[model samples]
Target: MDWIVPLILTVITASTPLLLSATGELITEKSGVLNLGVEGMMLIGAITGFAVTVSTGSAIIGIIAAAIAGMAIALIFAFLTLTLMANQVATGLALTIFGVGFSALVGSGFVGFAIEPLPSLHIPFISDIPVIGPILFGQDFLVYLSIFMVIASGWFLTKTRAGLILKAVGDSHESAHAIGYNVIGIRYMATLFGGAMSGLAGAYLSLVYTPMWAENMTAGRGWIALALVVFATWRPGRLLAGAYMFGCISVLQLHAQSAGINVPSQFMSMLPYLATVIVLVIISSDQTKIRLNAPACIGKAFRPAQ
Candidate 1:
């Protein structure tokens, strides 16, 4: 019983990065662009964030650096896919490859360095509440920010005019272009937003979750975030649910191994990923939902009229 809150807290920590990254990707996809370099962008963020924090001893500076790094990588993707009309899938893959190598090169010097982790923000009176307080009020700023992003994302998509225009572009760029909306420009903004979010996610990994630097530290969390966007059927609310679900599973897998379960370590390590595959299959089995919800122009390169 005593372990329950701690476990839940761990789950929240695990879910924060996924939630952040997926929420950002959801917006990008909503604008009719599918950028697959989230993993790579995240790696770039991780290294930059770690390096900056190490240099300045300020987690905030590190986080800002991470977001900027992510946006920079995302800009490259945007130029290739939106401006030059390259294949979105291939460019994303290449971006991921580049990020992996780039992070390794840049992070090599910071490998053994360490820094203080981000501090949790505990509301004085509220955080002291028996069970609810710690769970709700004792989390770090990023955790709160993730929840805010979900709410903000939902509002932006459903209630805002700009969001409508963005969706309009996604549904049919020709129609949007006919209506005088700048499809490429809107997509560029969305792509940069996604990159920033992915970078923040990576920063969370290095400066908050683990508080250290390592080559390729993002692992495959970026891919999971991409899957999470799809699993949510392009809905921000559902994306939150899915991210937390995965987070809990990840924590459980680690706890299972620590508990001396008889399963092989390798097999135990596969649990989170296995769960991801299962969830994807389940969600994708419903083609009707996907087709109805997915952006009509997703992954299609847009060319403005001359």
Candidate 2:
């Protein structure tokens, strides 16, 4: 029982960044754009957040800076894809490559440095109560925010007029444009929102998850987050579930290694990514569900009428 609580806590920590990044990507795709640059944006955010926090000794400010940095990178993507009508896939890949190198360059001096971890919530009485308390209320602010965003996103997508308009753009940009919606403008906003969320996810990694600076610290989680959007069928509720599920797999792999299981360390390290591939394969078999839920115009460049 004692171990169970800690395990759940670890899972929550592991899942937070994924939830944040995936939720943002979900929104981006929902608006008829596909920014594969999530990994790059996260790296930029991680380094920026750590650098700012180190310089100013303030985690909150660091987080804000990270979000801004992410938005800045995302802005580049928006300009190329939305305004200039460049290839989203090619641009995104280039962004990721650029992020890997740029983060390494920027984070060079910050390597091997450590910072204070984000503080956990310490509610007066409730937090002290056994398992349930810690599981529900003892996490850091980002954890709570991640959960809230998912629920709020779910509501917004299903219940709001703006959500419907975004969906309209995704399903048929031409139709949406006919209906008086600014397709490119909507996508730009969505892409920026996604970048902001991705940046926050990176901040969470540096400020809370590891509380240190390292090159490529995101460790391919960005790709997993991308897959998660697909796995969840683009629904926020399902996205939440999928994130925790992946988190469990990730944590379990570590635990397996710790418990001295017979598997090789390399194999243990591969579990989470392996699970992603398997799930994707399973989901791919159901083309109907994906076709039903995925945005119709995802990855297609939108060109407004002259």
Candidate 3:
């Protein structure tokens, strides 16, 4: 009874990072670009946001810095993947490496620094409800924003001309080019948005969850977010489900430890990841379903004619 509310909130909060990054990456992937630099983008964002917020005492500036930092890292990916036609896997790997090392170096001085988190706004009656009230309704604005972002992303992709064009570009670069859609441009923009979301997700880690930074603190959230895209079958609504599902597993493992369940913490820590692999195997095991779900040109390069 005591832990139920905190557990629920923790699960939802934990899922926010994956939710934002996956939603953005879904759009990027739907545009036919696979970005592996989400980890790096997120790290940079975490550091930048933390530093900015600590200095200015303004969460808004911190979030903005996070977004900018993510976009900046993403631009490097765009240059390699879209402009130079570099391999997405190689570029993504490099991004992860860069994020890990860079975050360690930049955050070395900020290991224990602390700052006040953004204030939470609660609805009158909802905020007063027993355990659920404070945990759910009293959350910071970013939590609500995460929900809004999901909705906005869904509507934009399924109900707009730009969405259709992005789909065409992802499905077939040649067809997009034939009709005058700028494949590179679309990919670059889409990837930038993905990076921004990834950054915001990272900021949440330092600014909200832990209120501190350590080397590679993102700890493979970027990878989880990537897998979520496939699990969601490139659909926003499904991605929300997957994000929360994964988040719940992750939170429960920790809760099990807190409850003294006698399991090793390391093993519990591994549960979420292990679950990810099992779920992916199950989802992709059926050939027909996999074919029906994958992006048509997920890793394909687009070269527009002169």
lDDT of 3 by residue, 11-67 (tens): 878988888888889999999889877878888888988988988889889998998
Q: Where in model 2 is the C-alpha error above 4 Å?
A: none
Question: How far in Å is the alpha carbon of 193 misplaced in model 2?
Answer: 0.5
Q: How much does candidate 3 score in TM-score?
A: 0.96
Candidate 2 lDDT over 1-306, as tens digits, reads 568999999999999999999999999999999999999999999999999999998888999999899899999999999999999999999889998999899999999888888778999999989998999989988899999999989998999999999999999999999989999999999999999999999999989988898889999999999999999999999999999999999998879966779898889889889999999999889999999999999999878778
Q: Indicate the residue-level lDDT of 228 in model 3.
A: 91
Clashing pairs in 2: none
Candidate 3 segments exceeding 4 Å error? none
Q: Tens digit of lDDT per residue, candidate 1, span 68-119?
A: 9999999999999999999999999999999999999999899889788798
Candidate 1 lDDT: 0.93
Q: Estimate every model's Cα lDDT from 0 to 1.
A: 0.93, 0.93, 0.87
* TM-scores of the models, in the order given: 0.98, 0.98, 0.96
* Ranked candidates (TM-score, high to low): 2, 1, 3
